[model samples]
Target: MFIRAESKALNEAIAPALCAVSAKNTVAVLECLYLNAEDGKLTVIGYDNSKGMKTSCDADIIESGCILVKGMKFAGIIKMMPQGEITIATDERNNVSISSGKTKFEIAGMSGDIFPALPELVSEKGITLSQAFLKKMISQTIFSYAQTDIKPVYMGILFEFKDSELRVCSCDGYRISFCKAPFSSGESLTERFIVPGKTLTELQKLLKDDDTPVNIELTRRHIVFSFNGLFFFSRLMEGEFLDYENSFQKVFKTYITVDISELIDSIERAGLIIDDKMKTAIKFIIYGDVLQIKTATETGKIDEEITAEVEGEDLTIGFNHRYIIEALKGAQISGDDKIVMSLNTPFSGMVITPVDHEDYKYMILPVRM
Candidate 1:
């Protein structure tokens, strides 16, 4: 399409949408960014078939047209160009030209007719939540999403909306993270969706402010996130998430409250030594009023004890150091000056809560060292 826009504004729109571009694209059109111009504004869209993103910026339309240009090359050009007006146009021969000031670049574009049709947002089941609350929920749980594809369903985060709250959960079998926030009334009559972790992270990055509210719509196959002139859509994973609630049954035989930073530092240092081990488990040894974290490996052994208000039965439990570190790093601990961890056995899920946040909770499944 023929349109003129500022370089920085164009880059801002292109960067987030480009996250959907697939490196191993099976279709040639999936590798390009689709541009559509209508009335006075131009819209940029990108999708790798499974996930799609659409974003728009104010533009001066000279001619109305649509075309698909190579995503990487277009993004690279936009990012390198200085702050100035950029003019983009496509000819009858499908040649695309991008010009800014004294420089101009031309690249061949494909017909937009071949691009996959975007899924419509079915508003039948949806909810409205503050961007601030949703952002916190995503950041805290997304790290637990599985990185492996052995179990395809585990690779994404689960969104369960029922009654009046949205619960976001993720687990790779070894660790599970759960967070929930209240939803507005008259939302989500009946529905649940599992969104891929990659998609959620992109949405999290695109949201620049916390004051804005995000509109989330869910269909049987796709979930749509809309805010601030941007629309993000992702294909939902198609399997049942594990029965997460049932796994919480194991009571805490021993619970302790310790400094959040101190606990994080202790585990991180222990990980330096545990890095050589295959399991990377850190042993938590608790006595009367203190707790000690230790891990051993070929390099050396790390041992650190932190003061805590320990009660109940004194016990030791093994946990995957990676999971604990991930949860603690983003914790919002307050009031009590300590992080609370409850555990029954290394095989059961361990619950970590910030003393500051009564509504927020983090769960991690421990590993045998």
Candidate 2:
């Protein structure tokens, strides 16, 4: 393969695709980026069997061919090259040469024929939404996904489309993050799938916060996301996601509305004295329009109070500090925005929702103190 392209354009195409390339893989080709130069463009692909990303950029294709080069090294070389044009070529021996104005380097490459083939990108079942909306939905829920592999099913975020609404949910046994928005596909589509958290994390980085639409396609076993000349696909997790709709409590004995920033600051202050190694729980005493936050450890103790609009029966509850902080932060609340907290018992999960809308809900299991 021989191609000439601007360094900036090449970096833009190669950088995002590297997210799918594993640093070390048992399959040698999985660690390499497949470069196919043809038809006046250079297409770069990185696949690690479970998920993959492909992107293309305009290039001067001297010869229509393909080769595989080490993903990390090639990306590094392109990024560090001079600001002008870059030329990449390969010989019969599979030796790859990358050069800029006054510098050049040679590296070993493998035939592109050995790289794993990506899944088919077309499907009849799919939805199109603005990149900003999808990015926000993923950011709000991804925090609750399981970080461990003990429950493989919980390690992904669930995407459910029904009744012209799309709901995204994630749970990690201790807490649940849920967000939904109205979506009209005109086809009355009802579909559900689970995408691995790792895939969404990388996708989030590439997603631009704009009005550009992202086309999502779902096959029997894979999900594809296409936007701005980039194709990202990941294998869908097998098995049923938790029935999250029914898990949230509908009744509450205590309700409190407080400023989002004030509450977050109080909890973060309490977190300062609590050590992760001790597994400490922050105690909340809510009564008479005042919420008292308290926590103590060998390091120190904190007692802080914040004003709130309290209703129903007053209650004292305990929760893992980190869980509460993460849940609040994930809400994407801003200044002057208030959140309502509802609780039934010390053991029941605390449900949080914005004071103005019900579009997002976060539930955290209370710690037994």
Candidate 3:
């Protein structure tokens, strides 16, 4: 393919597509980015066996052709090149040429035909939602996936849609992230899909603007997201995720309403005394309108208390530091914003929600300290 594109335009388009380049590939071509230039447009595609991303850019197409080149290296050279148009061309020998200003380089490339075909579902009708909401949903949930592959299915974030409400959920056995956002669907839809945590991480990068709408298409085996002329495809996880609705049924023995920043600040300051070398749990002692946070080890200790609105019962509980830390982060609460936490016992999960916001909930499992 012979095409000319501005350095900024080409670099921006190529960056997101590189997210799908297989980290480990047995086939040489799988590591290459597929480039197709035709009719004044250039299309870039990267695909691992499981996930893929494709993006297009306006280019001066001198000829209609296709080629495959190392995706990362090409992107690097384009990014480093001076701010000017870069010309890319492929020779009959399957070698690729890149030139900008006074610099030029040739890289070996392969036939684009050898690459696995990208999904072709352009004609299918898909749901549309605000890019900002999609980005927020992924950010709030993706972090809660279990780090281990012990429960492979638990390593994904679930997208459940029914009754015209879309819910995004993630849980690692110990803590759960739940966020619900309403959207107008293009058609009547009731479905559930588990998307791997890594896919959403990359999607966060691609879906940059909140004002734009994102088009999403789902198939039996894959889900496709399109926004800003970029297409992202991911293979759906192959198992049924836990029915998360049942997890929130446990009633609270005690519920506390606390300022988001005050609670987060106290937990963070208390965490400083925790020993990095051992498993540590933060203790919460609640009574009246005061909440005490304390943790200790051979090195030192921290005992701190902050104001809270307490009801039902005075309770004491212990939990791993990470659970609460991440839960606070996922809640995305700000100054003056309040959070309500429900606790049954040290053994039951503690569900935390932003006051007045029923659609968002973050749960952390307590520990025995």
Q: lDDT by residue for model 3 over 164-225, one digit each (tens)?
A: 89999988888888888776576777878898888888888878756798888887778899
Q: Which ten residues in a row have the lowest lDDT in candidate 1?
A: 329-338
The lDDT values for all models are 0.80, 0.90, 0.84
Off by over 4 Å in 2: 25-27, 333-336
Clashes (backbone N, CA, C under 3 Å), per candidate, total 1, 0, 0
Q: Can you give the lDDT of residue 348 in candidate 2?
A: 94
Per-residue lDDT of model 1, residues 318-354, tens digit only: 8888778787865652234567888676567778877
Report the CA-based lDDT of candidate 2 relative to the real structure. Answer: 0.90
lDDT per residue as tens, model 2, 48-143: 888999999999999989999999988988999888899999999899999987899999999888877787766868778999999989988988
> Which scores greater on lDDT, model 1 or model 3?
3
Worst 10 residues of 3 by lDDT: 327-336
Question: Clashing residue pairs, candidate 3?
Answer: none
* Shift in Å, residue 80, candidate 2: 0.8
